[model samples]
Target: MTFKELKHFLGEINVKVDDLYAEKLFNECDTSHSKTLEGSEIEEFYKRLTYRNEIEVIYSKYASSKGKMSVEDLGNFLRMEQREDVGLNEAVALIQKYELDEAAKEKKLMSRDGFLMYLQSSDGLVLNPTHTLVYQDMSQPLNHYFISSSHNTYLMEDQLKGPSSTEAYVRALTKGCRCVELDCWDGPNGDPVIYHGYTLTSKILFKDVIRTVKEYAFKNSEYPVVLSLETHCSMDQQKVMAHHMKTILGSMLLTAPLGGKMPTHFPSPEQLKGKILVKGKKLQSREHSMTSPESLQGEEEESVSEEDEAADLPEEKGMPKKSKLKLARELSDLVVFCKSVHFPGFETARETQAFYEMSSFGESKAFKLAQESANRFVIHNTRQLSRTYPRGTRTDSSNYNPVDLWNAGCQIVALNFQTSDKSMDLNQGKFQQNGFSGYILKPRFMRDGQTQFNPTSIMQGEWLTPKKLHVMIISGQQLPKVNKNKNNSIVDPLVRIEISGVPRDVCSAETEHIEDNGFNPSWNKNFQFDICVPELALVRFVVEDHDTASRNDFVAQYTLPFMSLQNGYRHVPLLTKEGNPIASSSIFVHIMVVDQ
Candidate 1:
């Protein structure tokens, strides 16, 4: 083929074939030096183009020099490199699983192509199969687990003008979110409705939201779902809301604590599977003793959590000190295991906090507590659940960094799921483990009150086993075009990796961009990170398109817990900005975790 034709052909296919690649192919394949020659040259060009030299080196090293990986060779590689303890039977089974050649399978050998296929398969993905399964101890109390939670679950867009629909609840549920927020207000015709109250956002009926929740609650995960209600309805309307939940949810709704009495510890996710728990203001006899109608109004103001109090308060504009609406007896009765209560100081909470009662904090307050009393916050969480949510000032419905709150052992670090960003990525990554059950057993230090674990003290004492993380970005395959509208605009793709955790462990680094190459870019770049507390650290791999004149545009990313990552040669799936995996798009990588 002529050079002009070759360049056009390269343009059609999504490969990073620049001038260097074109000239080398033309000079070597054009054996006759004819400008317009064709023959085995076409075959020669394609062969050299798709070949991966990095993989070839490993295959050559362990394939008995016979161009095939025998069971023993595969076993040795897994043991030494992948750190997997495999036996003869296991290696044979893997060969059968990955080997496409029938003859090679019968002889218990994996061809080079088969090896590459295996490396690209799910087994080769960075997430370990064990983590994808329900592998953790699930019998611990609910407070001992990190619950996958969402804030403003009904909003499909921005906080002020976004439309609120039941579909939002369905989406969050399907993604294994265990906790969802519902802002209920009085609606027309005595029916209650849900929306961002006092905002321009649209609203949906309360009954419809409950029905949708009932149907999709256990579809993705059988674990319990917590409905965090910020109710503003009058007593009569609140009774109607409770009736709807009772009739629609049936036995799935937990109306009373298990065993019909309060216990020192809450039920485990395993114990409450398929149940929906109501988290709202519950009336205390002391607060409700005043029979007068005027006194009843004060009960709601006192019992509501601090985060809920600021829900409708406009920033700087200030809301009027209206009479606090009373909580209905029926709706309050439905709040079984998760009764929302106002947060007192850390000292007060440690002394008077009940296991069944929980408190929600605005991001600023939660972070302040985490900073001033790291060990105290950890101890408080060991006995009672704490939820940290976005501040009211996030008019755009943005998310706060959850890793910092999570480090303090807050079980429910709620984020706006509709706003996909670094926060949601971290949330998804943390909950993606333990079979995506929406619950993860907390580390022993975080769950044990007597352990004296402090989030900020990891750098001082030898409490945590720090490790050296070595990541080698081998190459990228079929990275999507950032500007999809520009058919001829090829991306100069680069990989940016970040480690987020406590103050000291947070850092990031990037690779040099591959010019005009969104497809088949070989970086072979390596980065090292010293993770002091791997338990709390999150590793994020972000791919971006380089633009010298402007800031780099985001391409794709994947984030996961540092502890959940599998070592050795693995392929990382590239996810879009919305967290959906791009088809046939992945970056090949080599990872090693060494003890410090």
Candidate 2:
């Protein structure tokens, strides 16, 4: 195309151009070229066209360089255009086209900004940002098990029904439960109402229960509740109930487990929407029925051929058969499926060995499998097994612990607790010390008069409290020398102690004067002295403004308990007013005297 035509096309595409250059070219062309131009005029017109074409090529290369340009970059270019009257809508459309091209290069159909941009571009697409799509795997094992007593009050006898179900839920919430289990059965009118039994007398409207709970949560923002719905009825009934819950509550529905004899609650993958979780039964290894004589003979013959092949190998190549068996056992268990697979604890002859052996499979393998399958691996371990395999140990020779399962590929650790008290503390000291976050306390031994194996109580006190001390002592070496600057010498040395303790009043600080004016300049003012005495123990006090030359020093004293052993111990606020101790900050001085 000619230079003028090309410039017009560029303007239509929202490409900015210099106004002065366009004006100069247009003026020259209008003056020289007639309707039918001669050879020299035509040649000049072609030269101008060539120059404009070169500029267009360079501009196009810069704009489409990476197959995509940021909206900010495009916006900046548009804003700097000589054409001040360009339409904003046209500019945005052009920018979006470029962004789409970039998204294509990244193999993503939509860029992170694409959704927001699209929403702003048009109001037709009703995109709900709050609602998230969650897929359910029917074949996967349940990582978490929830039990709800919502219908227990109605089902049980009048004598048995003591506290209301709502009160029980509040108690559970206070004890720090992330998941609550509820059983739902088919009520009259095909509506799935929540109940623990098959009878109608036990049933309570699931909609009513959910509405009440949701209202409670709205009033209390801190409370986070995830419902684990157990479908006691048929798959079709469960599906109908799920639909009703979704219609009523919308996105507040957390996760529901599809349960039945031959379970099939979620119809298609699409219908299995929302945070739907499937609980698979734990599979146990069972003994195979004995084969006929002929079948046994065939198996023996195949084994013999394998042994013959092994015998032909060189001595160096052939390792011990036992070692080979061990290696095979380890590798076989490490086999991970790309799709969801119900993983019960290893139940082979090498079950114990497999538990320890499988630990070698690093986090990368575990994470890769989890991502590839798009399913979380639920690891089931009893309290006994967890205690055996304590966390942080390598699989080679380390014992099994609940934390170890977590450290391994297991995304969820399921532990069975049998205790009246809900507070469960695993007492993994190192975990508490290192601050590695994990789920509920596994099982542990509780001692009344003697140690006993029981379902450990979840109601336990804080395991550990971090003690932080920041004692700002005046540098003995920084003391003013006789020959050094004397104007900045220490005067009226003041020390302030700040201590944080549990219960706030557990620890107090009291300062005592060990020896007033004990240090002499003649003995070298820079020399460090042991100012701390037994009476001053546990008190972190800072010394300031010591006037060594005048032999006049003020020692502010405070004493605190040697140790504070309470849950949630922290740095307590030190009561200080203008660098001096207040009466509230004072603790009685108890000088422990010892004969020298």
Candidate 3:
């Protein structure tokens, strides 16, 4: 094949080869001295280009002189390195399942290629397979779990000029997001619309969003979906909003108390499965009937929290004086469990707050609260739910670090899922714990109402075993080009390893850059980290181009919980900036964790 064909073939495999790697492969494959690859020569070039000698080292450790691993050898390797105590029968099954050579399978032996294939299979992945399902105790109170949530679920981009669509709801729900925010306002002709209240973002119809939410509510998770409504509508439109939800969601809507009365504790995700819950203000419990229009016609919502006031905009804060809006009787009746309420001081909350009532906090306020009264905040979360969202100043839809809030036991740390960063990466890694039901049970100390665990306490490593993590950056295979427009631009690739968790454990280290080898760049550098909190830690591996003239550009990244990492040779599948998996790009690494 010609050079152009070779480039196209690389594209097919999701490998972006620069002039340096391409030139070397072309020269090596031009055995006929024709300066181009023929039929068999093209195939030969591919085999040599993708082959990594690292696999041979691993295979040699367990294989015989004939480059084959017998059933006994495979079983021993699985039992010792992979930490699986499988018998010889299971080893033979794996050989028959992954080995392409029929003769090797009949002999109950795995070839070198088959060994590598088994290593790349799902069984060989770093994350435990049981974690990919709902494997946690789902019967606990809702406040006992960290829930996946999305803020500004309608905006696909910045709050100022982004387009709002029902597709955003679909995206968030499909990603196992249990709670979604909807900013509702009065639209033309007695209809309600959803968008950023005072921004240039285009509007999506409220009914369309409700329909979309109903369709995808249980698509990814069986847990409840909370519609956090920021209501700014007339009484008539409020009733219209209620009508739309009732008609579209039908019985899936949680319209009444689950068993005729609210529990002292919030309902569990298991109890609320296949249900859609509305989270909004309800009229004060009255001597008069609650369903009567007279009780609700002029009844105003509770004062707008600081986070929801008009001042809570990227460009506009402390500029508006509005506080309350009228609540319709029909709309007020829909709020069953998650009653939106103002948060007074912790003293007042612990003394008077109901289990069904919840509060929302801006990022700054939540972080400050967690800093000043972390133990109290954690104690509060044990009984009632609290949500933390990005501050108003984030005009670009950036995310704040969620680990601090999580450490304080905040249940719903809402983030812009569209803005992929270290924060969102940690969010994804955390939820992978409970089978992606969007609910991960908090640690026992964080769950106990009378707990003595102070997350902000200076006494580090007291309640848990401190661990030392040793990571060896082996190499990268077929990393994508940083600058796609420059076809011939050769990249100097490097790896940055990050540990994200509590304040004391958050740090990063990077490897030296390879001069110009996006393909098969080897580092063989090891990094050591002292982890203070192993349960909450997430390990992120980022690959980037080392650009001296300007800021380094991103190449790919893989993030997972530190506990999920396998200790032996493993391939970390690389993902794009938006957190989508790239086809064939990956980084190779070996991980070892031990008690410090």
Candidate 4:
């Protein structure tokens, strides 16, 4: 019988089907009939049956006792009928006549799978089998794969070859990392240079760095390398450095944001033809706008009058101008050349903080500002926010978890491994548990002492080892497994059995058979034997042959219903001649219950 049919039948009779009682019912029903019924047929019979009087009695009893009947309690009632010599057909008829009001009660105890199906059909919360809410984000399109740092096999320091630092650029390109971040500063000659430090000693000509990256990409099929040129130089020098990057790298280099605009001055489509991506303005909140009362007066006036007077104001005065000098057309044209933008120093925690700080305004103005940006917001140091955010804090009141951050609006949250933040750890755990996809640690974070500029950390530290990071990621999912065992109540959940004793030649063949089938078998007495059992409702075991092959066999199946009061685990004695007790299998059965 279908599980639903069987459940329906039990429901009509004012009886419940629980793990243990369900197993008992299955055994009894199967034994009573010539052939086992399909799970569906069993369920259908109960669903069609009507129970009027029995339901009233059940309801009256529940009312008197101020208690509701559970699936197990219903099973117990059926068990009592069996003990009293009640025929299945007659009992079903009686139940159909009396018990009809318990359908809602049964729903509360559905298995996880069943419950999930109900949720999907009833509430429209489409969830995967793994229990993750499914939705889509328009701004961040899903990419098939991402390039990451090969930290397990390579080190960044090893790439710093010669005064050119070209080797560092080469190493990243050769590894197929489409994106590379380079630290830049002003040199003694007032030129922008590639370096990871704020001082000139670490600087290398910006042109050389771009040339090396371009050469590597050309040799490797024009692979896109998003070179993040972080500048610790004067604004004018930074703009000059951006120009040099465009000259040498052409379409192969990415320019950092310069005064709310992209670096490369692409006046025409020809300038953008083969160049690398250029990042435009950083995603910021409306709060970041530095509008003086003087600038606001004209905008406020424009709302009152729709005339050309509002348009008469100089565009420069109407809009906030770039703080440093760079051709206005160059800034505007570069925007058209850019492929995607990056938000440096934008933190999710900071955004969340901003949300609460603006909560008094009812809606978040910062969030609105981010939404207005056409590009994605790459949040840096998200791990810090995930780790340190108070779990039950008032400002954090939302069903949306950390994995929902990207869907909520932020594109990617970048994590730096060298920085120690509990929020990042927690966020990573949530990501794995929910199966959300996003970026991971790349070369920039893997380089030694790269954490200094990582806003979360004030000091530079040695690069985090790959092994430690992998372990952290793996362990994030380990707690669920551990909890399963720690919460198990069933005692004597496993019993080990050894099979042996056959003619030498026969035994050898049996051993070979086991080995060929990947079953593990071992010797015990003189009679060669294997384990077998009838399928039970409440328990499931992961069995393997103890002989050479380690092939799995059905050692035992419980005949009892599941009792939450009892541990989830259960044990049964091994059988020998004539259903007699013998040794049992040592395998443990991990039961997963689903109700629908």
Candidate 5:
């Protein structure tokens, strides 16, 4: 993007920019001396503008011209910015705890390198650079954990009339999505196409989608990719899909059983590293009822859309009549691990169980299970994988709350990634921890075969003691600049801290807002919460500009798992709407945890 174009884009996002800074940034990123950024240079330009450089900014405040800061200087800086009552001695101890002092070759001093190391560690507000990939144990069965997934991974906007592109797959995969859906139908020229059938969603070639997946399947992590295929094609087209996937994916496709015998337990991600498994209706085996005619008829009514039904008939003069397709043996062989099926209530599902048989439930069915058969659902998921998807009525591509299903141990709670609403926000926050690897091991109770824990029926009196959480929102440093326009520029910024957990009513906490100054706006206000259960708690910090006439406009926000929180003085780095870290933007706070 050119400097002028970049300025206009920033303006549309309500960001205030000065010409000098814009020109300088453009020049720095313009490697070819072409005045405009090209290729990866454009992404580099945006990163430089949006990504927060928190460590260098903090170090400059305390470091001298000699590029080193004394221990006393570091202690005083921490006292003023983080813990107001931190004694010099205590600050020194905290510094040592974070290993900032050790980075210095000389004793009693912190060098520039030491400050950078501290910022990259768990002690600083920024995310650890290495935390975005696989950092958790992958030895557990795939059925025993929650996997990050996206629904209709091709749609970029409204389901009925939106563009479908390979970029959608690229975005979700880069964000650590493990399971993605592919709705394939026969397209012109004998190639399969992916789109939301029955809607006006634009289509992309199946081969193009597969190519994109091949390039990015293991970019974020080596965990296997689950391709949830919804097929609407003839047997010939099914052969084409199998051939394209085999040739394109090569050895990456899991086409056979792991060993000679059926797997006693699902394979761990480590065992299927860099492989892609297809999930679709397989040809019927006499033992498995999922492929029965009655089951397929019932699922067709639930999964097929009006547009898809219309396509089946010869509506136009040149249009060919769509015929019912069967799963070819070649295609069925690819679904050896996970065979997608319809959920047949609780009783029938329990009687004939197959480890490879995976069933999906829409929002209504899953809600009924949660409300009426919570324990049954939880126990079933412990031994079998269950996928929960948004109801068909959600044409806008909106999402429902995925927590209830997650609480019941559903492995794949798919959401519409194209929408950045609160539902998607919660999904991002849930997977932000545990290395952001698109998979999280289920909690002990959910995995342990003996425990019959119900998320909605937790007894408050069962536990003897409840924990207390204390937090002080000291100040915000280098916050993002927001304004209406040049004439009505500047904003009155404030911070709101939200506490979320299982029961929605107990989630809200009263917090006083800080006013006026965007840079270094300090509230120093303390807030407390009595947590009956800490295992399901989540904390979200939102920075918004307080306005009298309308709702508070958002400036920046950050959310994460409360269990991953760092105690003592800590910085909370913020993320923009694009999910990139903001440069030099963070909220400083002091945290204290007490168990009653």
Candidate 6:
């Protein structure tokens, strides 16, 4: 493709690039300093953008007219791609172990459906066979689970200058993110728009976002979705957002309680299936009905204290008093499930009579609460939902660790999904085990009436284990081709097992690197790690290409919850840079949970 065409293509995918950056990219691709990329250079460019290896797998899968591959054919494909000759016996055994097809065991033929299922499972990436509706107790209240949530779900990239698109909402929802944030402001044509305020992030229409949510909210899982609205629009513009939501979401929107009487307890996920709940500030009168007169007085006193604090600030001293923004009653009524509120201290919050009331706190404030008055915060989260978001300084759209907050029974631990960092890894690890339904039932000890569990107390005398994790790095199949110089193009692949969590920093072990192989390479080497806190531990398997002169490049990786990890022989699916599963690419392993 021409340089101009390449720029246009990038634009179509919402990748904004200026002329100078485009020229630099073109020069890099054209390694010979040629005007355009050609041959190997062109192929390299396409491989970085798209799944070239995955497409090759699909090609090999359908190479035969029968839409199936024999054991020999499968082995040949693996060897050809990974540049390692895999034996037919081992290939047939894998097919049998994965239960690729009941007929495959007898006929030795792997069907297309079986191949697709293997890819979707991420080569045993999922802990269980099925990955939906995994709650042990469906009757448990909604607040009794650690919910998968996203912060600033509209921005596709960084906090500042990122392109805001409805695609972000779809991506988050499809990944079982139960809670999504929408920062709404007045836009052209009087319609509400979603974007990060006082930033260079592009705008996307609010109505378009609602439509995307309506289509994808319940597509992956039939659980309720909490739409956390950060409204900064005028009352008139807020009504437009309300109208757009009601019109677009239709019957899926939950605008009132299930019954006429107020909920004595929060509803369960089972009860709110296929529902979209708006979460924002409700009208004062509606809030007044829930709180007693004494509680209301206490809230007023707290508000006065906040105003006094704000008055002391130099910025506030010279600023004019802005008029109070009023929330439209129609929009306010939609906040039936999670009504967002400013968190008062734990003392005042305990006595409040509000039902289904929710509050959000910055990461720093949440940490302070968990540290100074951990028990009070614990008691508050038991009955009511709480959301924790990243602090304002995370300009790169980074995320905080949600595990510590989950230990405190905070239901909505929102993280920046745009940045696929350690925080997102933890979010994926926690949710991937429980069917990816966006809700995992909190531990019994963390429930509303239960006071036995304290996150601060890690030295529980009752439960102790010094078990060790023994893993056999068996082999890799159909590994992706390395995009590098032909002289050193063949990667020396190795498997690294990382045990991440508590007592100290992350502990890891690696296998000996196999030379001149990206495919069916074997180590058969044993590595072990002593488990200090099994309940809080996570295991991640990473396949990296060993380099002599430069940094080792990542090939594929999978992280899983240690408690739910399957024992014995298993296949781990590899993921691409885009976080999508690489078809027909996996690492074989043998795992054993043993005593220290």
TM-score of every candidate: 0.91, 0.25, 0.92, 0.27, 0.77, 0.73
In terms of TM-score, how similar is model 3 to the real structure?
0.92
Best by lDDT: 1
Residue-wise C-alpha lDDT for candidate 4, range 232-287, written one tens digit per residue: 45656656765766677653543332244433222221232234553332212211
Task: List the global CA lDDT of all models.
Answer: 0.85, 0.29, 0.83, 0.29, 0.73, 0.72
Candidate 6, residue 303: the lDDT equals: 12
- For model 6, residues 370-406, the per-residue Cα lDDT tens digits are 7666666777888888888888777788788776777
Off by over 4 Å in 1: 1-9, 19-48, 286-312, 315-320, 459-463
Across residues 188-266, which tens digit of lDDT does each residue of candidate 3 receive?
A: 9889999987778999899999999988899888899999988988788999999999999999999876786555678
Show pairs that collide, candidate 3: none
Better of 2 and 3 by lDDT: 3
How does model 4 fare in lDDT? 0.29
For residue 241, what is the lDDT in candidate 2? Answer: 55
- Model 5 lDDT tens row, 1-596: 77788877665543555689878888988889987888889888766754434445667787763676667777766665543455667546545655444545335567666665465455565333344555668899988878999988998888779999999999999988999999898888899999877667899999999999999999987888999888886677878898899999999998776764456789998788888999877765521332343544332112221122133223546655654556665677678778766666667877876778888877878888976777788888988888888877787888998777887889899988988765676678778876777888777777876566766776543322367878887767667766545544445667777776655314654345555456556677788877665666667778887778889777887877666665555788887765668886788776766787
Off by over 4 Å in 4: 1-176, 196-201, 217-224, 231-239, 251-275, 281-333, 337-412, 415-596
Error of 2 at 181 (Å): 0.3
- The clash count for each model shown is 0, 27, 0, 65, 7, 1
Which of the two candidates, 1 or 2, achieves a greater TM-score against the reference? 1
